[model samples]
Target chain A: MKKICLGVVGIVLTFFSAYAQTPQKDSSTYKSRKLTFDEANLVSSYYKQEGNNAAVTGGIGSQKLSDISNTIDVKFIKWDRKDRKHSFDLEVGLDHYTSASSDQVDLKANSSASHADTRIFPSVSWLIENEKNGTTIGAGLSSSTEFDYQSIGANINFSKKTNNRNGEFTAKAQAFIDKVSLIYPTELRSGGGGDDDDDDDYATTARNSYSGSLSYSQIINQRLQIMFIADLISQKGLLSLPFYRVYFNDNSVQKENLPDTRMKIPLGFRANYFIGDKVILRSFYRYYHDDWGLTAHTVEVEAPVKVTPFFSITPFYRYYKQTAVDYFAPYKTHISSNQYYTSNFDLSAFNSNFYGAGIRLTPPKGVFGIQQLNMLELRYGHYTRTNGLNSDIVSMNLKFK
Target chain B: MKLVKLKPKVNRLAVVAVSAVAILSSCTTVKEYQKNKLNDGEMTLSSRKIQKTESSFQSYREGASGANGGKTGGGCGCN
Candidate 1:
């Protein structure tokens, strides 16, 4: 009986010790309160266009232009004491372009200083999201600067999710204050002679814009989602480019003129659907109208086919049509009696088609075997307008984590 | 004659309204666990980052803008 008792005691001790050594369940969820690095994206694009409708030259000159643009954005995230997530995004963009039409601003000079310019834009945004409440608030400030134009922009946005997390509503307000240099065509300049390179020598005019937007997104099912968006935009102050020449029926040339105030409304819808296991279809439609007597319609569609777990190809097409604004006319088609006149073809009635294809690669090991490189995408598009304008653009994006 | 002219427009609008209602009514509540396909990057309802420049140029080249998460009227695109 003594031996049996000892054996039982040993067994009980072993069981107790094993049980005690087993790791206890952690009842508290751990979240890092410190700010953490999230991800970064680098985007680059090259665009070139050729046509004969140059607004600067009274809509009848070389409209060739080429631009190279690059932008980088970095993001960081942190959790506050209230368990709300805060995210910060900083982005900077640069663009350099050479336009054959801008050279005509001098009219008498070849390859003038106005032919090439560079622009830099930078923005910073902060967002706070409450997971428990499924709400987010964000604000951002942005600025853009070039030789003849400067713009400052600000925006605030808020979003809330439905109880079931299947739908979300978002609202945003934005404002921009801009300054445009009153640089006129050489022949039309009152003084007839000024240093083209001295941007400060010219007078500047203010142009301000404000807009309010609302959007709602709903998940139709496990494989499909849709969104509806609408915006009201208002602009006041200088609305026309001073360098854009307008030639009247009598062949008299003057600077383009437009109303000082404009209002616009745009309504849009987007739908995305996943088909089977390998394809996704995305579609968008927009209807736009403005007090300037311009009405437009846009439709876009894209299909992405997944060839592998890590690779996909997307093909897209877009159709856009717009009616001429009240102030718009072709070269030498305007009458001097009109209060507002412009020869800018962009404001004239036209239709355009844009088509493109893109490839994306996201390997498990990372793109190009670099663990930090999360994805790489390359895309090319061709755009053609019915009024004899054609352009091509190539874009690339790289994401790092 | 005027009524006949307006009849087609009314029919078109009615068809659009009915289609939208049908689509919305068919929506099913999807749980988070069943959102694998919905979570795909390509399934996003917004414009892709790669289309930023495209959107910029379009806003400049075309008279119509806004409602696409892009700048409506800010900087001068006079080039």
Candidate 2:
């Protein structure tokens, strides 16, 4: 409610400011004098890739794994009479990573590393829309090579954008089905002394989730837009940590066993500011709490400043902190024989900070003798975790009409 | 009744059909829409950054054992 009021006040102030400032266009007023919705682009980039240090762990027995992935994607969009819409997006990609293991708690020491498999994944997307009535429906199917798993999802969205294209309401319901395929068994598992599934080849399970998304987007005049989104999600089936280990008496090791069902709801706010003709301000904040008795807060900020008309540099920063789940323990801290206990740092008490910058360059009109070169983006990221894991990533993307 | 079980699904289908129509309608003016756009040099979606920002969750990528879902592709030993 406060945000809505602020938006209204901002729009009113902007109107007054513009009305009072009787300005004449000098050097900058060269071409267009109006905003046309027809100039809007539906499909932008066809193929893109990005690499960012997705996670980090730094403490005892710590290991670091960073990713470098590249992808090729394409899209086909068509519009029938009466503004009906259909779009198909197909993407294929590969990923490679390096990892290290340690006997001690210090991730930096004895953290020797090894690289593994180049994976291929393909996905197909379908989208149907009716902009006039403010409704959208989308579904997708995708899979990975190594996991031999597939994801099937569908969503329905309802939105109302005001006549001025401001102050919009949107709600979405989505669901997904995921099949688990990743297997776990360290090299030493041949001894049959392994705590978890020494004789089991794989533990397969099906996971399903449903979510509701609600949002209000407002254009606070021409220079600013802000939106708030709330997401409620619930998932069930095999939520275990396949690779994480739990140490018990005499360093007895066990795989993580988690509850079959979990629930989470997150509320977030996003704001975008037209700081200048060539600079933009984007900021977001989210508060999340789950049924597992865990709470978390995340905040992020990004600024993109245009340079030379065809290139822009974006710098971003994020901070995240979460409290431990009820069944989390660092090592042997688990005393109860409960059905759910995990030593995974993902469930343990920890905080992390991610800071990075990226540069995007697009050819100006008529560059490279290509009439429809939409974009080219390059990005990199680095993340640091309290658990002694740090990683880096680099990626690139190309867009074409 | 079976009708009860089908209510949400049917409702979703209707919404999807409507939304699809909305999107298709958008394409009718693509040529016209291409004339007055900003970010014409290249396209940018501020929300897309959210996908990248989501990586900080740790659980999103680490837990999936490499589910590799969504727009971004990654290679990590989180599995």
Writing each residue's lDDT as its tens digit, candidate 1 over A93-200 gives 878889999999989889888999988899999999999999999999999999889999999999999999999999999999999888888888886334566657
User: Where is the poorest 10-residue window by lDDT in model 1 chain A?
Assistant: A19-28
Worst window of 10 by summed lDDT in candidate 2 chain A: A36-45
lDDT of each: 0.89, 0.53
Residues A155-198 of candidate 2 have per-residue lDDT tens digits of: 56566765544456777776767665444335324433223323
Residue A33 error for model 2, in Å?
30
Candidate 1 structure lDDT: 0.89
Task: Compute the lDDT of residue A34 as modeled in candidate 2.
Answer: 30
**What's every prediction's RMSD, in angstroms?**
13.7, 14.8
TM-score for chain B considered on its own, for each of the candidates = 0.83, 0.43
Clashing pairs in 1: none
What is the TM-score (0 to 1) of chain A in model 1?
Answer: 0.92
